[model samples]
Target: MAGTATHHGIPLRSGSGLSYRFDPGALGFELLPTGGPDWMARYEVLHTPEDLRRWVGQSRLDPTPEPEIGAEDVPAARALRDALWRIGLARVAGEGPADADLATLNAAAARPPLVPVIGQDGAAGWAAPATGAQVLSTVARDAIAVLTGPYADRIRICSGDNCALMYVDTSRPGRRRWCAMENCGNRHKVRAHRARQSGE
Candidate 1:
């Protein structure tokens, strides 16, 4: 999140204590911004096989320990991320997601993300090895549901400074802008106060 450089052609941001943006339940699209900028200097979280494993855990897509993630999993995950970003951006712009992106997403959705099983005491839970491909599929399925679901219209890009994170504006007025008040919202308020004092 601090250092700037390139890794395997993708921009890498490295620093201690760098954390992911927002809570997991806030938005499924948060993974796309993991690398950094959507266009330039993006630090791909799925850059390595290990990164892929960590991403699955971080996303909470599956807590099950995954088998070895291969080199191929990285690109597959990145492709899914890109497609989700495009689809989300299109919705924000009042346009429909492209056919190609939809197709890609649908394909992934068709795959079984995880197995279901009855747990102790008759409770149900998902079970799986949490392989790399399955993780990507889970994310794709989430994106598809969000884009096609009722709340899709409420999605918006965060208005915070230098923040490209996307989120659902569940505010009552539906006029929410920043991803979170503690992060970008406070920054905006501070800037506005400075401007007011400067004018006085």
Candidate 2:
């Protein structure tokens, strides 16, 4: 009732200092991951060190149960994992018209007219199936719903520094200071202090 929601495998919290848990349903993946941008980006969000220890560790993807992927031509497995999480770590939602973000995500996830995939190019030898991709897309849309729904107004990206991490503002007046009081909040405070000292 009072826990954070998992967004595309990333844990989005409601209140500060509140802990997180894991859910593979949030990851949008059935097996694990290979390479490529899609897999890489998703991997990044789900496998960060601290995040792994917190949420992902509890999930099924923590140790990577060795999916049969021997394709060296594919993206680097180890690097893809790290890269994806780093990029996702930079998830900072913007304000102004919240509906815009919501709308965009919704549109991307909007159900397309149901049509049968007739094989990649009629060759039938190796036609990429849309079933898996389609399901994954749907899961991604659900992830966005997790981030923006319920408390769209209170959700915000940190404006304290160059960082862009998303955080829910839980201050009394709804004017939260930073992405996290321990990270950007403290950094901004230190910068302000040095500026004042030099000025004085």
**Candidate number achieving the greatest TM-score relative to the actual structure:** 1
Model 1 spans > 4 angstroms off: 1-20, 24-27, 36-38, 116-125
Model 2: weakest 10-residue lDDT segment is: 123-132
lDDT of 2 by residue, 85-193 (tens): 2323333323243443344345435643112233335422112232322332333454455345554355455676554444445456877766555555666789999
RMSD of each: 7.6, 13.2
Residue ranges of candidate 2 with Cα displaced over 4 Å = 2-54, 58-150
Q: Could you give me the TM-score of model 2 versus the true structure?
A: 0.37
Error of 1 at 195 (Å): 1.9
Candidate 1 local distance difference test against the native: 0.63
Top model number, lDDT:
1
Q: What C-alpha lDDT values do all the predictions have?
A: 0.63, 0.37
Q: Per-residue alpha-carbon lDDT of model 1 for 1-200, expressed as tens digits?
A: 01111111112222333332464233256467565335633455557888866655555343434544789978777777777778878898999889988887787777766554555665444565546666566667777777777777888888976777677665678788876566677778999999999999
